[model samples]
Target: MTWADSLRTAWAGMWSSKLRALLTMLGVIIGVAAVITLVAIGNGASQAVASRIETLGTNVLFVTPGPGTPFTTRQVAYIRDNTPVARVVVPLLNSGGQLSVGTSTLPAPVVGTTPGYQALGAIHLAAGRFLAPADITFNRDAVVLGANVSQALFGAGNPVGAHVSLLGQRFTVVGVLQPVGQGPGVSQDNSVFIPLPVAQFLLSTQNLSAVLVGASSPTAASQAQDLLTNLYTNRFGSASSVTVASEDQVLATLSATRATFTNLLAGTALISLVVGGIGIMNIMLVSVTERTREIGVRRAVGAVPEDVVLQFLLEAMVMSLTGGALGVGVGLVLVHLAPLILKTPAVFTPSAVVLAFVFSTLVGLVFGMYPAVKASHLHPIDALRHSG
Candidate 1:
């Protein structure tokens, strides 16, 4: 039989058993869809992290206390004065507890930071103003609320100039930060900001939890990181006293880790494809047995062994390809809509789509081979005598 004739016959056979064909294709559809959706989610998370890092400035480096004691306020001043590339150095004193506004309470990550912390972190006031140098110098009991914190505390009411109790002290809300979504560093939306000295006094410690440093440029940031590392090593008499990292370095590390995790997830999802292939193989084997007499008649008339094999192979591929097409549609929809459900972005790469389709096709070809060969190898007389 001609290839076209074999193709039509294969398609007709599949069409005749529409329900079975659909049932058999379900495996491939599910496998492909799962792989695409998982990969898209992984890619989206990576993108979110990268974008957050970028928004925070690659020229920024986070310096945290590593081993021994935390950095002292004087030590922070010394680093600012000595570090060549360091342009802005902000000391951070964290209050790790809940804040109360009337009867409402929420765990707002309270930070005591310098005036430069606002600009360095791209923080803008939605209402009122940030901590001025006077506030920091005088150690005033003024506080700024993050967007979410303000909403949770005051609902629709403006929080500026309102009082919120923190660590048994009443702090007047001087400002409310603009809504900045969760990002790489501390979440600005769920935090409370106060002057550095007030935070130290309230938290009752002069030791700094961390220091935010901004360099003149990306290159300068790297220089600043190295210089800070060396300076801390000398001052603390050990390399373990401080942890310094530029945003770029952190981004690279995070990207590599995400890539590894993505690969692992994709590999696990691919196992479903293998299972789908096995399903196809088993179903096709049964198909060959059921159609033995039909195959016998074809071969007895004029169909060559290759013709018989091709017919069965075509049927298998068409089913898988159809499944793959459907899977792609379902996956694309999930990628577009899942972000809303997951509250994270979902990025669909062309490479991912192509890979899924190609893998599904390969599955069909690989799994269909055995059944096609078996059907083709059967003698016409034997096949004719065989019952379904």
Candidate 2:
């Protein structure tokens, strides 16, 4: 028989038991859909984290003191004055406190930093201005509200010039920052900013939490890291006194970690495909037993063993391919809706779609082989005598 004739025969045989055919295809359908959905979610999470890292700028370096002692303003000043490669060095002191504006009260992180922090290009003001040099020098009771904090406390109205209480200390709102979203080390939208001196007095700590250093370029950032590392090592008389890392280094580590997790998730999803293939094998074996008499009649009517194998194999492939197509549709729909459900973006990858479809087709071929061979090997007289 021609390929077209064989395909027609196979199609007819599958339709003869429509419900059984559908049931056989169900496993493959679920497997493909699961693979696509899981991969999309994994890719989306990776992209989200990468974007957050990128927002911190590739030319910035983060410096933190080690376990023995915390950083001081004098050390921060020394670095700023001596490091030529560093464009801006900002000392930061972080604390958590409850903020109250009238009846509205919310708990959020409060960051204390100098005016040089603005030079990092991470902060953008929506209204008024960032902390000034005078604010830090005089320990002014002024604060800048983050986007979310502003929205929660003042709603649509202007927050600048409004007075708010932080940790029970009253302060005037000097500015409101634009929405900056979450990034590595800080959630810019959820925190408040104050002068370093004010934060030190309020929090009762003269030691710094961290220092942000901006460089002219990525090359400069590397040089600055080396310089800061040496400076801290010598000052504390130990190499382990401080930790310095460039943005690129941090991004690489985070991206690698994310990729590993994504791969693990994809591997877990692949097991479903294997299970589906086994299910196909089981059903095909049963099909060969039930169609033994039919196979005998076909072989008696000039059909060779090869023709019988081809027919059975084609039927299995058709079911799998059709199921894969339907699975792709279901996966696409779920991928689009994933953002609403997961509260994060879901990226549909073309490679994932192709991989799933191809894997399903391979499953059909591999699983169908044993059953097809069994059906073809039967003797005509014996098959005819066997009960249906």
Best by lDDT: 2
Global lDDT of each model?
0.82, 0.83
Give Cα distance to truth, residue 383, candidate 1, Å.
Answer: 0.5
217-253, model 2: which lDDT tens digit per residue?
9889989999988888888888878878876776777
lDDT of 2: 0.83
State each model's C-alpha RMSD to the native.
7.4, 7.6
Worst 10 residues of 2 by lDDT: 47-56
| Candidate 2 segments whose C-alpha is farther than 4 A from its true place | 55-58, 62-118, 121-212, 216-220, 223-244
Score candidate 1 by TM-score against the native: 0.64
The alpha-carbon lDDT assigned to residue 50 of candidate 1 equals 53
lDDT of 1 by residue, 99-213 (tens): 8977888765677888888668678889999999999878789998889889998988898888989888889999998887866533567778889888887777878877878
Q: For candidate 2, what is the TM-score?
A: 0.63
